[model samples]
Target: MAEPREIPEGPAHERVTVVLITWQRREEALVAVRRLLELPERPRVIVLDNASTDGTAQALREAHPRDSAGGRRLDVVVLPENQGAVARNTGVASATTPYVAFCDDDTWWDPGSLERAADLFDADERIAVLTARILVEPGGVEDGIVTELRESPVQGAPGLPGPALGSFLAGASVVRRSAFLQVGGFSRRLWLGGEEELLAADLAAAGWELCYVEDLQIHHQASVLRESTRRRRNGIRNTLWFTWLRRPLPAATRRTRDLLRSLPPDRTSALGVLDAVAGLPWLVRERKVLPPHAEARFAALEESQRTSKSRNYSR
Candidate 1:
């Protein structure tokens, strides 16, 4: 067996577990797991397989037999049905760590990034999610969207360890376990793409702060087969759903109009908008607006949302 990476000693041996959500990308998932296993933090890892039919469960078990038994080991949870973000909730339930770092099947955390994230949570009481700097692969370039996070237009108090973020990138963030359970993990309805926004808003409403940690890093090598068009559709739909679910009526109406006007005059955007409106009956029944202060934060991010290259509704 290969010797594990050297981990930093902290206040005792606090475990930090990693939960990676995977679908059909078996090879990419294996590579990511390999890198994660090499992290200096030596996190207990779990791969949440969302009913993948491509032999992912078999591959994982075959590749890491010893990682499955005795000691603090890697566990693979295979769901019979596709539960989307709820798969993450199951993975979190299975983790025994005070912190859980989420990584996508195609992404990997830096050497000691998980430990640093765990340290931040250990030191702070108010911080719920510590979002990391995401760099794209091979050439190792900064994801352009990261620039927006770094120079976040949202105003926060001086005492904050990092910039206050309106939303988090799930694949590149470390979340405190207790806080995550308190606010509930990602939404089941939002499925995969851009699912973090609604949850972030809810976490803030519950008085937990989400911060951008510059020191921790996660690398994303976007997979070639990712269904980008469908992801775009879901992003648009989920954005609209979030707008209706929590924003005040006037704010929701205005935001909906703005989204409509800004969207391309094509069938895709049309379907996205229509899908959102189609769920209006439930949206109205479940509507719960944020308090004025929380609403203000959402309002403040509107202009950035309008201008961001990351806000595109198309792949």
Candidate 2:
């Protein structure tokens, strides 16, 4: 196995901004932002509070302290209600920098991951997102999902940086601000769980590529408080929604069959099916099949998904 790459220290670009989304978990969010602030390059930081009720807003105010007094400039937006993945859309609009890196409250970039991602995007105009290899905290174990990402089946012409990815982990990737906004941010219907797929396909259709760089790394300490069953249901529902939205008829039918065959005969699968059925009207109206080349690229992922242990339909 390749040893982990060290983060580069020099400024890779003029300015890169970090957009972090948080809710309820005030303490974890503070730790992430503090680590980000300690990085040498001094990237700009913004926090989107998704109507956090656990004193998150007050904690941020006390921590920054001088946003109004010539201290570190931290932009904070408090939404009136919880917007889930849509919160990211609101936060990205507030970013003025050339590149934006998305970090969940429980994740933080390695010292120079942001700078290196900026450099990668600068080197290739067609690359929209540079997904970092995520390393789990404390244990230092590689994230289970990284294996599937590293071995992506998406076909790319010769000499690409890494496997051509259909989608990326939103928390572990650095994206071009303009390209991200151009394709439209995460979908509102999908909301939070595994929301990157739809936007990724749209970006690919718009002539953008997503790559995985083994050299880049982000540390993630999975949060303790989570709704696992609900997350699983949402992930399955969103998978179905994205499939119908972009896949050709035969490919979509095959995917549907695979999902049904693999899912356990339990309440979770039933809820997922119900959620997917509830959105059928909108899915039909909004469906725009991918062009031939893109369709082929997506079809390539089916084989990978079949063998991927990381894709288990559970929390």
Candidate 3:
């Protein structure tokens, strides 16, 4: 772990910007924005509305028109169309801050987490992203994914703030702006579900590290309004796509077979497989296996991933 910094005595607005991307769920998103604006960090926030027909853009704009001093408390960018996770790319591009904390409409950072994340980034240049501990709301219990992140089998560089990680959950992580841009942000081809894997791999390959910091925290309330079936389908499909795009032939083939074998016999699982097959041409064209070091990091996680309840493709 790195030594803590104690010279700060102010809001974290200048060093970190919160990026929230939402689609369709106007009410939930509005509530999220309001809660975020009330955070003590007072970080500038950018909300990306994915061309929602439910007037999410108008609602967010109306709810947070301006701050107490009439400065822009929130910047809402309404996309021309739904861009899935890609909406975050635009939000991050608009931020002037060096660090961008990716917050889903259903989640928000703890008051001091963003500030601490900025400190962690300042302490280590190799750290590309630091994923926070997530406590599911209503009871504030640890999320299942936290266990996987904490017990990650992949080793990280010594002196990192926490355990090293192969990938991060975007909604609960803070990323260095430069490293993220260097790798082209989130993948358009991946769109939304399970999209962080590819970006994490690219960051690792580019000599950046992703870590899971146990002390930094975020809160989440699973949105009932989310499209579960589509999320599952995309998560499954993207898993296949990423595996094929970066893993050697044998690992890719084994991963695909193992994934398919584990999936429930349902329409959603079938559609996910079909979608991955549909992208065969693109996958083949873009296939570039990671270098030995980066490849080894991901390979180390196969054992844990196979047994992870959090990684399961189910509602």
Candidate 4:
């Protein structure tokens, strides 16, 4: 690991604050915080420790005992219980900066990338979300989803950094704090896996632009301690709820059928479907179809989503 360097206090450094959520991953979270503090931008960081029994909160406090070199504080909020992805909502609420970048326990933004992201937000007032090119750690290879983001079929409007996107990767994205709050953060109902899609859709519906910026980078070292099967289950259930909540009747039906067809014949898939069915009443009550333009963008991505290797539910 590189030694922590002093960061200059400036407008760029003050533009964004990072919000990371972790559960039980104490060592990984500490390592991530160290790398984040070492960034040249030296943005403020807040870690939401979701009631980890592993002393993650204590480790984080010990790791960042003082403010960053840029004079921004590293704060930690230890929740009473595991709120899953909703823990990010608390972190975002605590942020004083205009932009909030989401990070997982196993991920960290690259040096200067937060500043670059802030520049993009400064350039475009309508850009609510800016997703970075994620490079997996160790080999530093581009994430499989990076290809999908790069080849996004959505047409980009003038002045945006890269292609337009209908959805964003929360762990690798920076968002306007106000816009994020206005539309609400991640859904508590969706929990963690694949939670970004619902929030992204709501942002789009409110006329906020989401874009992919290749220059901004994030490093993700996927943690070994993960509940893959449970994650896949939640992801599938969330997808179903999102489809029913936002897509038109025909589109929703078609998507649900397609998803069912694609899922492997297993107990997990069956349980995911059952869980989705159990939520139908609530989903119906909250369902609001996307506008024509936003729906069209989602429609354009169906084929790509179906073919995406990164989105597979197989654990």
Candidate 5:
């Protein structure tokens, strides 16, 4: 593995680094990286390629060649195997900046947003994660999920930029590197879909605050190169795993029952349930219920989550 790139000096470089993960979406990844590089913040970016069969690694290298002076604006790490969301953890581990902004293959931060996020982190030491308002591409309309984030039922502290959040969307959030590492980053077992919740919960439990900042924005094109059914399956399975891993027995049982009732009676749903059940032994061994304060925050968001249009399991 290459050594983590040094955060370039001078006012030209932002104190934030972008950590993007891509798998098989080579074209989208290139577009995202190009857009990120065009930002005024000039943030250093690390791309973690999860063993793409396509020429994503070579394409990235060609697009952002290392400078002959031994300085680079971009660094690409091509893993031998796909590690799913854990690839972001690897990218975060390789970040030298105080803050890391995560973007998916089809997402890019809006210009000046990274600078604003860095300023927010600098202003509040307790703030660990700041989720940006996501706008879909083409027409640049606000994503449905942004409404829930903006109207968060969870209460905010005095210094937060917006409403406090019980969880954050990993694809559009900037996080304090130290706090993320302290919480051990994303869970390897959960892999990819809906993986941010467990880490967000742990951060809250550790006394770090997460908030939604309307001024900051991320653009997501929602790549067509995706496995919708597989994503839905993993998402359902991971949600169950997380509920069992962190919620109290009563909450977990209720959430589990609700999930089962809501899921479609199909092969994908069956497989997800099977996968979740297979992980019960590990969940039983590692279960640590959230603190009352954090649990209350989660409880407040339950209604919103249940009614969310952006969180549907269907393709």
Candidate 6:
């Protein structure tokens, strides 16, 4: 095997573990596992296969069986059914490391990124998450979300390493284990699409900070095999769910109205709105307004969220 890349600063293995979540996409998961295990930090990995029909879990277990990297530093957890983003909670539970670098099957962190993240976490006990700058594959150009993260208007504590963020991209972020578990890893109701917003809000409410880091990078080669319409539908529903679940009554109502008015006139939008409205009972039961400080942070991001090209709901 080739030499592992240099470990930049912190004790990476002790501080961080990579928790990769995948559903179907067997071949992509295989390649993702290989890249993760090769990281210079030599951090341990837990692959949570979300009950994929594509033989994803079995292929992963076969590829990295016991006695190699599999035994020494890898684990594969095959969920019995698709738990959506909550599937990641299981992986996070099993991680012994204090921090987890969350990965999607199509995304992987840079060699020294985990180490840098650990150093940041060590320096600030209040920091609960650090979302990295993402560069897409092939050409290695910045992802559209990078600009939003880099220019985040949310005010952070004095010692944060970069701009304060109202939300983070889970696949490209490192989160503190304690804070994540404290707020419940991800909402079971929201499932997969746009789930990070809820968790980020809760973490902020609990006095934890989240910020963007430019040097800590993750590379995403978005998978070609995806249901864009389904994802779009789910994302729209989750966005409405989160808004009503936490935002103040006025804010929630306004956001809901704005969202509905802006949605394209199509079956998908109608279906998504229906998805949101159908859960009125449970959503009403679980709704809790955000504390002033946390709500303020989100309020700060309103202008950017409204105008963002990357925040489009239409496919």
- For all predictions, the C-alpha RMSD in Å is 5.3, 5.1, 3.1, 5.6, 3.9, 5.3
Tens digits of per-residue lDDT, candidate 5, 168-216, equal 9999999989899989999999888889989988988888889999999
Clashes per model (N, Cα, C within 3 A): 0, 0, 0, 0, 0, 0
The TM-scores of all predictions, comma-separated, are 0.93, 0.93, 0.95, 0.94, 0.95, 0.95
Candidate order by lDDT, decreasing, is 3, 6, 5, 4, 2, 1
Residues 236-276, model 6: lDDT tens digits? 99999999899999888778877787789999999999999
| Regions of model 4 farther than 4 Å from truth | 1-10, 67-72
lDDT digits (tens) for residues 21-51 of candidate 3: 9988898898888888898888899999999
**Candidate 4's TM-score:** 0.94
Q: Report lDDT per candidate.
A: 0.82, 0.83, 0.89, 0.87, 0.87, 0.89
Badly placed stretches (over 4 Å) of model 5 are: 1-14
Q: What's model 2's overall lDDT?
A: 0.83
lDDT value, candidate 3, whole model: 0.89
Per-residue lDDT of 204 in model 2 = 83
Model 3 pairs whose backbones collide: none
Error of 1 at 161 (Å): 1.5
- How accurate locally is residue 101 in candidate 2, as Cα lDDT from 0 to 100? 87
Question: Can you write out model 1's per-residue Cα lDDT over 179-277, one digit (the tens) per residue?
Answer: 888877888878877789888888888877888989999999999868776777777888999999999888888888777777877777878778788
Which stretches of model 3 miss by more than 4 angstroms? 1-11, 67-70
